[model samples]
Target chain A: MSVQPGPATALSMSSATPAIEAVELSKRYGEVQALDGLSIAVAPGTVFGLLGPNGAGKSTAVKILTTLARPDSGSATVAGIDVLRRPDAVRRAIGVVTQRSGVDPVATGRENLQLIGRIHGMRGGEIKARTAELLDRFELTEHADRPARTYSGGMQRKLDVAMGLIHRPQVLFLDEPTTGLDPEARSQMWQEISRLTGAEGLSILLTTHYLEEADQLAAELAIVDRGRIVAAGTPEQLKAGLRGDAIVVELADEVATAKAATALRAVPGAREITADGHTARARVDAGASALPAVLAGLEQAGVLVASATVARPSLDDVYLRHAGRAFAAAHEQEVA
Target chain B: MTTMVSHSGYLTVRAVRALVRQPVFLIITLMQPIIWLLLFGQLFSKVVEIPGFESTGSYLDYLTPGVVVMTALFSSGWSGMGFILDMERGVMDRLLSSPVRRGAMISGPLAYQAVTTVIQSVVIFVVGWLAGARFPGGLVGIVVTIVAAILLASALASFSNALALLLRSQESVIGVAQLLVLPLVFLSSAVMDIRVAPEWIQTVSTYNPVDWAATASRIVLSADPDWYEVLWRLGGLLAVAVVVGWLATRAFRTYQRAA
Candidate 1:
């Protein structure tokens, strides 16, 4: 309940005050530790992504930071306002687009926008103008008068985000904003989100399970696992943190995967060989130079390889290196 | 305080607008009370002829106020469905995370319910008049009857909201509301006269808020309205409304913690 600034503020303020800061947040629900000592800082006018698979506490962190829920232990600040002590102030300073669509399905798109604007204490003319502008911006102007339920899923999501931005908050929280969106809609949303920090001069904290989403939109990213951040850096830095390039070989069948892993390990610069199903993956100092040797080794070992490829380190590799498991595997485990 | 009032006003409009968009629901809800007034009024017209079943006019006159009060009970009992829908659709979280006043969330819907009760009561009164029910207490009596219904609806709506916030499930809210409404309706003079009912039923109705509303409405619409009885019951309904509304607003904290 204390309102005093936490260490995250002190540390980040020394450089430039973060638009959002959370220090050692921990939350427990019965036997599940939803969030454990999670800390993050987003610089002003930049997109910071919390990247994690499902149940990695990404949404939990967003909830605590946005003042929808409180962390059992820890403090947070949004727009220099204490989240725990003065949640209303934080609420005024930030706009939150939760993972779920928050649009009132029975209300028209424009009505939803106006209602939210009024809740934020916007004036009549201001609410009207802002609502129109947002509807146009989100390509929802044509459907502004229709009940939100009539809108497509992507359109409803767009209206939800538009309602969040109606008040022009200093910081925006997009918690898995593109979740459940079609590929085209997701890319469009990414374009809009990318433009927000620059065009609107708003800092954003987005959480997503998609590695490509984090890589495409975040200025800085954190990999969350089991309620804690396992890695935090720029997306490029996270990928570069892996020792070398990744060389993956898809075996013809599960029976050849083990042999392929052993064969790939014999290559001079390759290391960390692991086999999964019908695929074998290894790291090499250089992918282009190591590719021929890898394929040759597989051929010499009589391991029938269906395909072989070498590529620069991706966010997937970074996640695997740190989380000690494949990202897709972790995601599926959480889903199941 | 001003912000809370304004926020409540805006949200009330939102709720009303949402309801208006679904005209089918509105018609369906109105149909229930009209059907009850017509069917029950005809079916029980002879009950008034029994000994000790005192009445100054036809049976329809006695049943009109009862029907109004019953409509309030039945409609307000379902008010929680709106809250449950908001919760499921994530609209509750959106409002909670905004700078909106927490109290406004409860007050807004309560206000909407009040508005609905007025409309429904007026419609029932008009339908009763068309069906041969006449009010001797006239305009003042009609206004008072509507006010009583509003008060009762507000109280029940607050209770419904509290249940919604606590249960956070549509099926359970519907189940609990259905379970409570029938006993409240039949146990009172809403349909049957308390004079002819069992002594235990009469005693139970005395403490029931539903009975207070129906009895008060019936009294005001009578040839001789009792000022003391009308005011006392209205005051009691007001107190219950305030208490239940406060509890509903406080239930937001529990929802927040769980969220």
Candidate 2:
């Protein structure tokens, strides 16, 4: 088989460059600001995560970079093609698996793959061979002739990924690939996504509302909040950068949270103490050493130490530090 | 091969397959026209004897052309329902992200409407012939009848698709489609003569693309065929098809901007 020059061929020569880049991208929808000067650079051959809670603009960034939507005042490039000026060129080098299942419910799995391949300009033989391979790889061979709506959630998600890979794109964009799946299906999808980069040399940009998804799948991740990247680093780096463990204290009395905060202030090892109605939390360099001091201080001040625990810093702490609030709290605020 | 041809071929096949897979739906939808062919042909069979009803000897001859156009309108006007389904299912987003020819994306559904109309025309004409309606123009007349059906249906198909994207809601598209088709059909000569219609409706229907189709098909099916008038009406429907289809393609821009 002769491989003629195609738009995706240019992606190989651009291996030295970042696979995806978005600079100062902004988009506004009526009263909601979907993206505000958001930007990120993804290295070639790595899984990059744009992690955020619902309504945090993660999907907005994906839409812009994938050439499905345009930015108001910013620019993006995928596989070295300007997304706005040469969107068709960018499309040739990239594949997108949107948050929702895109497979035609009326069409069978095999027909879905064949249809997408034909649109990509693949020959009939190439389409048939690739469809067979994907159906097998995704373990969809048995149900290849069945309409996609009949498949299990995991099966459907697997077919969605296979559809995106029909053209062997250089970069793949998966927008919340495992959003609605159950735990088993979610883990299965995670495993399938992790294997895409092994032999294909494909760069991936993933967006998700689940923190564990980013930690488990992305090599590098950016935590997005309110249309901005609040913090970015490898999951380990972001967690380690917090410089210690977190000490959380829950009081028996909701009104005594302020008292509990004051009681825990004397511990020299503790810092950044804050409290809500029934809980108070602090950062300490060493949990084992700091636990006794924390308890003792509360006792001396006549504050009940209802319960205390110290755990290593997590991405939750990383986001709390950068955003000045707990990650879940911020997410709840947006949802509410 | 150009992307438009090859890409549209696959997409059109998908549409047709969807129809074939749901045989009951296809049957039910096509049966509506046949019901009209029998009910209207028999109920109003004597209307040809009424003054100012310029039908051939048999009212079925006049009603046959109307039935052909009605099948096209009813089927094609809901063409956007497919797009609404695609949007709801995220299939439209998938196609937009691919390098499918932009034209192919729009033409695929339009072509499906054309193909189905041809089948429907054949069915309607076969039934019309059983009711004693003779085609004075023979093969050319039958071809012209099918062409008129396709042209009118494709025009409504484009507008329906445009409304589907612009509204992005099945309920709203259905509402607007009903609003569009009822009046256009009533205003046109598809069901009745100008003398039977109110003066205002008759005047308004002169501009109705549906009437343009009905006029051309009625002429070509008549014993005294006016070839020039047929060209004029068919040309009008074709222009409307191109314009509305273009508008539907433009609606994609609106959808993408919001997506």
Per-model RMSD to reference: 4.4, 3.2
Model 2 regions lying over 4 Å from their true place: A1-15, A251-267, A276-279, A296-306
lDDT of 1 by residue, B99-153 (tens): 9998888788988998898888999999999999999889999999999889888
Interface RMSD of 1: 0.8
Name the best candidate (by DockQ). Answer: 1
User: Which pairs in model 1 have colliding backbones?
Assistant: none
Give the chain A TM-score for each candidate: 0.90, 0.91
* Highest-lDDT candidate: 1
Runs off by more than 4 Å, candidate 1: A1-15, A252-268, A288-304
TM-score of chain B of each: 0.97, 0.96
